[model samples]
Target: MYKVRMRFSKKDFMIFISHLDLARVMERALRRADVPLCFTQGFNPHPKISFATALALGVSSDGEYVDIEIEEKIDLNILKEKINKELPEGIHIIQCQYIDVKSKPLMAVIEYSTYIVRCVLADDVNEDKLNALIKDFMKNKEIIIHKIVKKKNKTREKEINIRPFIRNLELLNKEDCNCIFKMTLATGSKGNLKPEVLIEQLKDRMKISILLDSIRVHRLGLYSIKDERLIEPLEIGR
Candidate 1:
């Protein structure tokens, strides 16, 4: 089998679709495109596709990745064109490239994700104060947040210190109660941090109220360490 890595974008209405539904949509599109997708050998076989990470509900991403195993090698350009033609609006293929079959799956290799968060702040919140708050927040060695996890079918809230998981968080721009932030956080099998959780902590610490719906998060990209440098999914195994 030939392994092909594809980068795509999730935006607009597609951002609300669940990960399972997105998988179904991709499967349907692949079938319609007539790509020779490889399937597992079993009574109930499924498409051989794996996602880098699942974008949270209502979140958008500019760089989402999936690896597909095909029965035979096909032209990357042709493959990209075929898939894009079948995909619905708000989802489009950005690029495609082949990778080593023995390379680790995207989910296992991804280490960090950068996000651009845009939100409206309360009018009373001053820009300078917000900047100072961010500085102080990062200075703390521990920023604890409660996370709900299901263990043995029992759901409970667990307090976790997320400071170590946060690589960088900066206030990018603020104007007239509107603000934007850039965040780089841990993501992968080792650890994961959601951008919203960080936002919630900031909101409370800043003593400001932000509409839950007004907060919009768009993932810039996912990265893995290669030769001591961060690289995209397509460059991971190379």
Candidate 2:
């Protein structure tokens, strides 16, 4: 079996699409593009396509990934061109390459994800106070948040410390009422932290009155931990 790895971007209205729907869209696009995809042996066969991670709805990402198994190897450039023509707006294939099917899957190797968050502050908001709160939040050893967990069809509150998952956090820029922050958080199977959850905790701890709708989050990239350093997914085995 030949494996093809694709790097794509999700923006505009496509960010609102659920992961399941996105998978369907991709399968349809590949069929329309006449790409040679392999199918399972069953009464109802399906294209062998898989995504690295399911991006949250309403969040935009530049470093999305998808892997597909094909019956034969195809020219990367030609494959990208054909698929791009069939894909809809806001869903663009950035890169495509042949990879070893034995290589670790993208989701299994993902360790962290970086994001840019921009929060529009109110006119009365104090920048100094916000900055102080951020500093204090980072200095704390444990920032616990109660998460609702469902077990055996019953829901219960479990306190989870999210501090360990946050690798980096900084206020990148602030101009008037717009504050921009760059954050790196644990992701994938190890542990996953959403930018929205971090912001919510910050707002609550800082006593900031910013509305949830005022915050905009964009995922910058995803990385894998190698020798205590962050490396891109594609660079894992290379």
Candidate 3:
């Protein structure tokens, strides 16, 4: 039995680390932590770690995860303690559990996610305004955006629609006076949507601008759909 999984977060400040670099960091961390991890039997052996999905650079997450392979079955609680002692700030393993045969791993399991997009306001942005804008955007039968798909080459086409791409959507907050956004983003292995693409389009649609001010994006959770229903990653099905 050599399979395990972990979920953690990348806060605002540490969002600069790319997913690949983050993967390398975790590999080193595991080594330093001294867990008896299983490695692929090859000329150049490597840790059997698999990241479910990657968060784009400069973005934060609340529902990020990775799956790992260990040499043998061990106490998850003790393994967590040993790893936590070696993990750096902003990378805390919230849960460590045995792989369930009936359940899917993080990457394959995730179908959707929630995000909070924050920006500075030119004029006072309150709850009413936020709600109104998002409401208007949703009514759009087709929302066209410059889709950045492949890293090596970006495809530029004009006749695409975003309405079907989105699932449950909402806008949050207006009390603080600064522009804050709470939107549920469509994510998963099948078809994923990023909050930024929508935010950029929203900026165009509303004629709003985000200057030097930073937009803090937080991903709340990841859900999987099975039998036309949503399933929580860490939850045991009832």
Q: Which regions of candidate 3 fall more than 4 Å away from where they truly are?
A: 101-105, 148-158, 207-213, 227-229, 236-238
lDDT of candidate 1 over 6-64, digit per residue (tens): 99999999999999999999989999999999999889999899998889998888889
Tally clashes: model 1. 0
Q: Top lDDT: which candidate number? A: 1
lDDT measured at residue 229 in model 2 versus the true structure, 0 to 100: 95
For every model in order, what is the number of clashing pairs?
0, 0, 1
Q: lDDT by residue for model 2 over 167-219, one digit each (tens)?
A: 99888887878889899999999999999899898888877665678888898
Residue-level lDDT tens digits of model 3 in 45-129 = 8887887667877877777777787877888888887787877777777777677534555677677777778777665655676
State the TM-score for model 1: 0.93
Question: What does the lDDT come to for candidate 1?
Answer: 0.89
Alpha carbon lDDT of each predicted model:
0.89, 0.88, 0.72
Each candidate structure's TM-score, on Cα atoms with residue i matched to residue i, is: 0.93, 0.93, 0.84
Pairs that collide, model 1: none
User: Which of candidates 2 and 3 reaches a greater TM-score?
Assistant: 2
